[model samples]
Target: MGIQYFSQVLIFGSFIGLLGWTITNQVGRTQLQVKSREDWLLDGTGLTIQGILIPLLQATLVYWLYQYLLPIQQGYLKLPLILAFVISFVVIDYLYYWNHRLLHTKLLWKVHQVHHTVTQMDVLGTSRNTLWTSLLIVYLWIHTLFLYLLADPTGYLLGVSLTSTLDLWRHSRLIIPANTKLYQFLSPWLILPQDHAWHHCCKIHNYNYGANLKIWDKLHGTYYKSKNMPSIIGIPSSLNLFQKLFFPFS
Candidate 1:
C-alpha cells in the first residue's frame, strides 16, 4: 500500500530469492547467453529517470487514490476475507495481462517499446516500461474497486505486494533448482525467470504476459508453453537516447 516497511522488505527479499533460485535452477541455465555490459543497462545507463520514477510515483498515486477515492466499507460481497483476497489477486492479474498485451499492440508500441528494447533480463527489467505504458493498466482502479467492495486495505496491499514481488523475481535471470521436486511444482504457476526470459526474447514468440499466474495467457491466445525452443530477446530495433527519453510522448 505504501513504501515497504522493514519487515515487509525482509519478507519480500526472501521471496525474491526464492523466485530467483527457482528460475536459476529450472529454466535460466538452458538459456545461458552472455550479455554485454551495454546490454546490462539498456546499452549503458539503463536505469532512466523515467524508469525509476514511474513505479514509485505511480504506486504512491494509485495507493493514495484507492485509499481515499474508493474507501473500503462501501459494500460487502459476502465472501470470506481469505476468499476475497484470493479473488482480488485473480482479478488484478487478469486486468494486468490484457493491459500488458495492449502495450504490445502496434499503436502503443512506440511507448512500450522502451522496455522491450533491453537486451538483458533481470529483476530490474520488470519496471522498464514507459510511465504512460505502465499507467495504462489502471491497477489502482482495480484495487480501489476491490478494496471498496470486498477487501480491507491491508489485504489489498498484501495482495498487490505479493504480486509485485512475484513480478520482480520472474523478470530476473535466475533459474529454479532442478534437484528439488518442490521447485518443479511451484515453477509452472509462479512465472519463474525462465518463463519471463522467454517473454523478453527476440521475436516475442511466447509473450507470456501474466505476472502472478500463467492462466491469463493460457486462456487467451497469447500463451507460449514450451521449454524446448528458445526465444530471441529484445526489440527489433534500438532507440537512441532522445527517443527513449521522449518515449511516453512518441
Candidate 2:
C-alpha cells in the first residue's frame, strides 16, 4: 500500500506539474494575477500538503478501517464493479456538493478561505487548501470506506483517479467559452472553469459547489453561469502565507 500510494503521488505530481505550466502559459487569466511570488510559493506548499500528504493520511485511515472495521476482503456488495464505481462516483459528487456549500457558511468559511486568497487561476491552485479542508471533507472518509467495502474495484479506482485528475482543469486558467456548442451541451452535467471561477472570483453569492459534476448545483440553486470572466479574483486577505497555512489554529 505504501508503494502504491507513493507511485500514485509521483504520477499525479508529474502530471499536475506539466499541466500547470501549460495552462499558465496558454490561458492563465493574467488580469487576476495579484499575488506575489512568495504567495505562489505558499500555494505550492499548500498543494503539497493537501494533494499529497492528505491523501496519504486518507490511505492510512482506509487501511486501518480495512484491517479492522471491514474484514471482508472480497467485497460484500455483489453488484458489478463498474456499477459500484458509477454509483460511488455520483454519490461522492453529491456529498461534495453539500460539503463545499457548507464550507462557505459563516463559521466554516474561514478554514476554506485560505485557498480563496490566491487571487488568480492556476491549475496547481486547485489543491491549494488548508489542512483542515480535506481533513473534514466527507468524501475523504466515505470514499475510503467505499474503497474497502467494494474491495478496491478497478472501475472505482479509475473513476476516482480520472475525475480527480480532471478537476485540475476547473482551477486552471483554461476556459471553454459558454457560448460554444460543446460547452452548452455539457453545461447541464459538467463544470468548466467558467462555472467554477464564479466561486473563487467572487466575495459572495458564489455558485457551483459540485467538485466533478454540476448536477447537484443544477438540481439545487447554487449554479451560476456567465460568459464574462471575473474582473477581480480572491477576497481581501492580510495574512501572510505562513499565517494562512496555520490560521484559525495558529
Candidate 3:
C-alpha cells in the first residue's frame, strides 16, 4: 500500500512538474499558444482519461477480474526486489515493444493513430489517443496482473513509476545533449527524447517502438538512429473533435 501510494505520487508529480516547465519555457509556450482548440480538446481529454479514468478502471475492474480468476494465487509470486524490477523494467518492456509494434499494424493503427497526431514533442500531448485506446495497451492488463501476483511489489512499482516518468520526459522537449556523459551512458540503453521523436516522425514512424529500452528495437531491426530531432513530426489527421475522441477511423 505504501509503495503504491509512492508510485502514484511519483507519476502524478512528474506530470505536474513537466507541465509547469512546458508552460514556462519560451519554446514550449509558443508551441502551446499555436495549438488549436481541437488540439487542446484532444490532448486534455486524452490526459484525463489516461492519467485518471483508465488508472481507476485498471485498479478496479481489471484488478477485480484478475482476483476472481486467480483467487487462490493472490500475492503468490514472491520474487526478489531486483528480479521483480527487472520483470517490469526489462521483461515486460520487451513485451510492450511488440505490443507497440502491433498497434502500428493496419488493424490497430486507427486506434493508435491519435497518439501520433501531435505535431511536436510536448508532455501534454503524450497521452493523446482515442478514449478506448487504453483497452488495447498491454500496460493496463499486465501491470495490474503483476501487482496482483507479487507479494512485495515495491520494486515492480518503482519500475512502473520510473517508466511512467520517463514516458512523460521522452515526450517532452526537455532533451539532454548527446555529447554529455549522461546522454552517452543512457542513450545506449534507454529511449531518449530524440529517439522517441523519430518514432512520432511523419517520415519514419515505423521505427523505434520500444517503450523503456532501445535494445528491443535494435534487436528487431526497428531502431532508427538519429542524433537530431525529426524535421517533420506527426501525420496529418482530418478527423473532427468527435471522431478523434470517440472513433478516429474514417
Candidate 4:
C-alpha cells in the first residue's frame, strides 16, 4: 500500500509539475493559447479518463478477474527489487513497443488516431485518445498482471511510475537541448521528446513507437533519429467531437 501511494504521488507530482512548467513557459503558453474548445474537450476528457477512471477500472476489473482465475497465485512471484524493476521497465517496455506499433496498424488505427490529432507537443495532449483506447493498450492488462503476481512490487511500481511520468514529458514541448551533456547521456537509450515528436509528425508517423526506450525501435528498424523537432505534427482528422471521443472511425 505504501508503494502504491508512492507511485501515485510520483506520477501525479510529475504531471502537476509538467503542467505548471508548460503553463508558465513562453512557448508553452503560446501553444496553450491555440487550443480550441474542441481541443480542450478532447484533451481534458482523455486525461480524466486515462489518468483517473481507466486506472480505477483496471484495478477493479483486473484484480477481481485475477482473484477468481489465479487465487493461489496471488503474490506468488517474489523477485529481487532490481529484477522486478527490469521486468517492468525493460521487458514490459518491449512488449508495449509492439503494442504501440500495433495500434498504428490498419485495424486499430481508428481507435488510436485520436491521440495523433494534437497539432502541438502540449503536455495536455499526452493522453488525448478515444475513451476506450486504454482498453487496447497493453499496459492496462500486463502491468496489472505483474502487480498481482509480484509479492513485493515496490521496484516494479517505481518503473511504472517513471514510465507514466516520462509519457507526460515526451508529449510535451519540454525538450532537452541536443548539445547538452544530459541530452548526450540520455539520448542513446531513452526516447527523448524530439524522438517522439517525429512519431507524431504528419508525414512520417510510422516510426518511433517505443514508449520508454529507443532500443526497441532501433532493433525493429522503426527508429527515426532527429536532432530537430518535426516541422509539422499530428495528422488531420475529420471526425467530429463525438466521433473522436466515442468512435473515431471514419
TM-score on alpha carbons, each prediction: 0.71, 0.84, 0.97, 0.97
**Candidate 4 ranges beyond 4 A from true positions:** 248-250
lDDT for each of the candidates? 0.61, 0.71, 0.91, 0.91
Top candidate on TM-score is 4
Native-referenced Cα lDDT, model 3: 0.91
What tens digits encode model 2's per-residue C-alpha lDDT throughout 13-34?
7566746565457345353355
TM-score, candidate number 3: 0.97
Model 1 residue runs over 4 Å out of place are 1-79, 144-151, 228-231, 248-250
CA-only RMSD, every prediction: 5.0, 3.4, 1.2, 1.2
- Candidate 1: what lDDT? 0.61
Report the Cα lDDT for candidate 4.
Answer: 0.91
- TM value for model 4: 0.97
- Judge candidate 2 at residue 134 and give its lDDT: 77
Write the residue-wise lDDT of candidate 4 on 1-250 in tens digits.
Answer: 8988998998899889999999899989988898899999999998999888878976898778988999999899999999999999999999999999899999989889889999999889999988888888898888889889999988899899999999999998889999999999999999998999999998889999999999999999999999899989899988999899898543
Q: How far is 42's C-alpha from truth in model 1 (Å)?
A: 6.0
* 196 Cα displacement, candidate 3 (Å): 0.4
lDDT of candidate 1 over 125-200, digit per residue (tens): 5556543454566674575566556534555556766776666666665556655786679766766667777787
